[model samples]
Target: MIVISDLRIAILGLGYVGLPLGLALSRHFRVFGYDSNPIRLRELRQNVDSTSETSSYTLEHSKITFLEDIKDAQDCNVFIVTVPTPIDSNNIPDLSALCAACRDIGSVLSSGDIVVFESTVYPGVTENICGPELESSSGLQCGSGFFLGYSPERINPGDRSHTVETVCKVVAGQTKGVTELLERIYGTALSAGVHVAPNIRTAEAAKVIENAQRDVNIAFINEVAMIFKNMDIDTGDVLAAARTKWNFLDFEPGLVGGHCIGVDPYYLAFGAQQAGHEPDVILAGRRINDAVASFVVDQIANMLRPSSRILVLGLTFKENVSDLRNSKVAELVTLLTQKGFQVSIHDPRAARLQAKAFYGIDLAEDLDESYSFDAVIGAVGHKEYRALDSSKLLRMVKNDGVIADLKGIWRAYDFPPPIRYWRL
Candidate 1:
């Protein structure tokens, strides 16, 4: 019997999700945090988290041992895999990282050990795909020799309110004993408590739908935003009036891109197709959300000259963070460039190297007061962009330039007669 007292945890992938989780769990168990990137390990050792999810003070005070080599965590019996499960170029579920983590854990998996997955995936991935992979690499029976568990992670990057310790956790296991074990382990660490799922597949389904539902809701708002644009109405004003209803879901429209909401719906759609069902609504939502960048490009292009010199603000996936995975701003920039506009991008929050590496976007070092553009586009609503008042905006744009606020950040600002303002 694997007792709660004997739990030695190994956390794989120390990025956004794993870093915070490893720090929280280290308080309750002996945690060995491992990431494939040696540079990430070195940064963490010096109390630096590039993801900005965890602070330097927290890293310096944590007792968890960080490791670059997965082999160093061989003694850990409880392995929690928090690696990313992103979609490939074809929008198919890429289980490369998940499978590789399973193989790594299997090499060190001992009898009666438990392997829990916190990465978002389709319903059958934990049992149908990962189980066989673990069995093949470990040479052990899944249920009897080693156990499998699923607990979907709910960490929201750049959101400090809902964290691993504060949010309710959903967990499941292959057997009743294993389920109870996970409940005890997670229950002790999280003050928000745990919801024990009937089975592993049920837990997986719950996680995927959480983000898929958001995708559909945002798609509805995005479609509405475009319709309002054609009608010469402001989407922000319409939403402001509609929000008087107490139960109205306040979902703003913008480009949907990130690790979860932008990617998880594809996993659900793929699983539905594999089970002989066509997910029409789910797919329609994805298509609508994907086309938002193009719609934005077309709207802005119509207002400016063909040879207009434009400036784009912010490049990260969302406001106030350094995470650039699956960012829709890159697509928007590409479309603007394809339209023959001379575009220069500036993001105060995004790393210069990552901006260039991920999207071939060379971020401008600084927004010089003297240099002006024919048009200024507010793509991402970072705090720095939000603080740009009317005077600062006037200094950046030419006399007859356009200010396209895609995120409604400057909707209330009153620009001069010469500066034309547009938003969706």
Candidate 2:
């Protein structure tokens, strides 16, 4: 067994999850942070965290050595994989990034090394899929020549409270010894302690369902929002009235985007179908949530004139974060564009180049109140947009134009007679 003092930790895929975890672990162990993106490596070297999860001050003072090439981490005994587990166009769980990380780590894998995966995936992927890939590449037998562990990542981008050190970590291993090692590793990093699952697959299942449950809850609220829209009743008002009860679950209605909630349910759904369960409620929730962008666009389009010039505030999936992965705002913009609305997007947090490259939509350089649009849509609830005074918001919209609030961030502000306020 490797002691905490002797552990040489290598964190693969230093994005939102791996970077902060690496910084925390570096306090106890000699850490090597490896990422595939050269640009990311350069940015981190200069103490720039594009994800906004880590501060430049923390990055500059961290002891972990950021590496562009995997070979630099050859000496590490504990390799933690935190790569993305995205879905295909068909919504199938795509493990290409996870498998590639395995192969990369396998190339330099040594006897008695432990590879722990933090990427969210369905059950059996660690033992069935990733383990074999490591063995085929390194010619090492699982549980003997090397070991595997699971510690699902809980990093929430743009969230300041629940962090890597604050959240309770869940860990499992192929063997009791490996599990104990993970306990010591993560336990030292997280002040909130850890929950040791019985096995690796159990840990995997626990992680996948975390996001799936949130997806379903939000889907229900989104459906209710649509239902209330027909009756001309505000969903916010209904929620406020329902909250007087003790047991009301408070999930808001909005576009479910990001790498987690929008994507993880499909992994669970895929696993259920493979086990012969239809997963009716799960798939139905997905369908309702996935169609929310179109629903929002339809409502906004009906209120606007054909070929009306529109300005959309915020393009990232959620507010106050630069991460645009699987953002539904792009879908909203595309839908509006298809309906003959001339739309321009403005998100101070999102990367302009990435937005253009990913969606072919050019983000406005700056918010110019001097050039108002026929309508202004609040698609995301960024703090910057939320802090905008009513006068500034009114200035963004032309006379008799609409103020479409998708997330209800500006539901209280009553516009003048010529201008109208609309919300989902």
Candidate 3:
């Protein structure tokens, strides 16, 4: 067995997950962070993470070296792959990014080296899909020439409480030596400790279902939200009463966006189908969650006049993150635009250039100080929008304008007058 302290680590895909983990691990090893995106690399080099997961102070001070070229990781003995696992247009799991990472990493693989995947994928993907790709690309024997491991990333963008260092790490490896190596490596860096899964596939399954389970729970709340609406009752009021009892799950009803919750369920369902088992409940949750944006739009349209101008606050998938990928707000904007309603969107945390590039959304600039519209929708519950006084919120909308509170952040506040509020 190789000495844990003697290991050289190369982290592939320096996004929301890998970057933080790399920074944390750098304190204990010779960490080399690599990403295919040169633009992201340039930003990281300047200590500016567009992802907002890392601070400039940490980025500048961390001893970890960031790299753009794949050849730079040749000397590293441990490779951690934390790339995104996205779903295609048909909602099928796309492994192009993960496969490409394996091919690149395989080119640099050496004997006794272990490639650990942190990306969220269905069970057997790391062992069956990635292991073969690595062997084929590197011309090496699996578990003989180089080994494999799985450590599913548990990163929640915009979440300050359960950070990479604070959350528990689940890791599994092909061999006992490899598993112990990971336990010591991650356990040394993180205060939350690490769990050794029985095997690599078990770790993968654990990560995939973590997000899928949340998706199912949220779907139930959303379905009931729609049901309560038909009964002329507010879901928030019902939830407030229901939450009085202990053990009541506190999942809110809202648009399920972002990479993990929206995309991971399909991976699980796909794996289930491959095993010849029908995954009806998983698919049902996805269907309900996916329909949330359209349902929100329909409710908004019903309350407003045709061709009414609506100013949407917060465009990111969640509060306090710059990521706009798979954001349901863009879908809401598109649906409203198609319905002949003029929609102007704004998000304090989202990258403007990326938003325009990704969704062609010309985000309304600097609407915080002064802006007025026929209606104002709190699409994302960002802190800035959350802290807005009731008078300020009144100023954002017309006297008879409706306030669509998606996350119910403002449900407790009493607006000045004539400003109606609605939330799921």
Candidate 4:
């Protein structure tokens, strides 16, 4: 309802998604970044980003105001909530973070203000759940007093290629005016473009299925990889040959972990089951991806004898990212360690204190150069580990030791005959 020239944008939950977005939005508007975590605020005050999503140069140079209390954003007319929407132990959508964010925003809401969400969630969440909470806390009607919008975040953490400036933003609102207002507001930081969806629920469905489709594709590849493994064939080699066709999808087989691809499908599946439909394919993909950790451990455990000294390279969910949230490497390490094997992990990018706090696994300060392992697993494809030569990999293992490459990073180079090379 306000002029676009007078835009006052407030970003909530300054984590991986919020930090980069806040910085980008600050380029066009007077941006206020708020977070409940004191440590995150302290780090940002010092121009330090623990998530590694934003550079020190970007943080130090940005004109955004980082705040600890929610009331500091009271002056802003537009609030963008970019909090996490994780699943519960039973894999149901946990809206605790999203609900809490709505309450925080509602407390400072005024008439004619607008609130948009960038957190990933099931369809109808914005209208059914968050809008009512905002109305309750603000003592105002949603459409009459304040407006609601949904612009699901497409932030691929640690990805420098498809950044906030490059990726296309999908925005939907309760009305055409709200949608057009969002298009102009978010379009300031985006050069790629903006897509105006038909409605809020359609936009929400589009976002959830993007990651869910990726999970299913990777699950197919993983299932094929398992089939080829039983046949004693190299999945990397098979993929290399199969990818010659132009129509072949470029999905690789590996442990599907991370915040988005690993978890978003369950959000979709839950919605399906609640509507009296069986989400057979969606749940199947989830089951296969979930079982990969234990399946990998079984192969390695069967290869080596009891009490084998195993070393896992890289601990984060993906390559070049320091994020340890929902890391399958940590899961594999726990499964291996529970079987009485001496498992040591080395990841140069991961935070040691956070890793211990999150997973109860203390990262070694440095790799044991004096000692070698019975097996070394390349869990993640970090550049440091990926750039290592074959000879260096050979040295980390004893004679006839195993080198399990989960990422298939070293599938091309052949190790010495004494080294038992295996790749998934």
What shift in Å separates residue 136 of candidate 1 from its native position after superposition?
0.5
Model 3 lDDT-worst window of ten: 363-372
lDDT of 2 by residue, 123-172 (tens): 98999999999999989998999999999998788889988999999999
| Runs in model 1 lying further than 4 Å from the true structure | none
Candidate 3 residue lDDT tens string, 1-424: 5687678999999999999999999988999999999998999999998888888998889999987898999999999999989999999999999999999998999888999999999999999999999999999999999999999989787888899999999999999999999999999999999999999989999999999999999999999999999999999989999999999999999989999999999999999999899899999999999999999999989999999989999888888888898999999999999999998888878888999999999877788644678788898989998898887888888898999999998998887556778888
Give the poorly placed runs of model 4, Cα more than 4 Å off: 368-371
Residue 352 in candidate 4, Cα distance off native in Å: 0.4
Full-model lDDT, candidate 4: 0.91
Could you tell me the TM-score of candidate 1?
A: 0.98
Better of 1 and 4 by lDDT: 1
Query: Higher-lDDT candidate among 2 and 4?
Result: 2
Q: Judged by lDDT against the true structure, how good is candidate 3?
A: 0.91
Question: What's every prediction's RMSD, in angstroms?
Answer: 1.2, 1.1, 1.2, 1.0
What would the per-residue lDDT of candidate 4 be over residues 1-424, giving only the tens digit for each residue?
8798888999999998898889999998999999888988999999999988887888899999987888988888999999999999999999999999999999999998999999998888999999999999999899989999999888787888988778999999898889999999888788889999999998999999999999999999999988998999888989899999999998988888888999999999988887788899999999999999998999989889899999999999999999999999989999999999998888999999988998998887786462489999999999998898888888889989999999988987888777888888
Task: Give Cα distance to truth, residue 314, candidate 3, Å.
Answer: 0.8
Residue pairs in collision within model 4: none
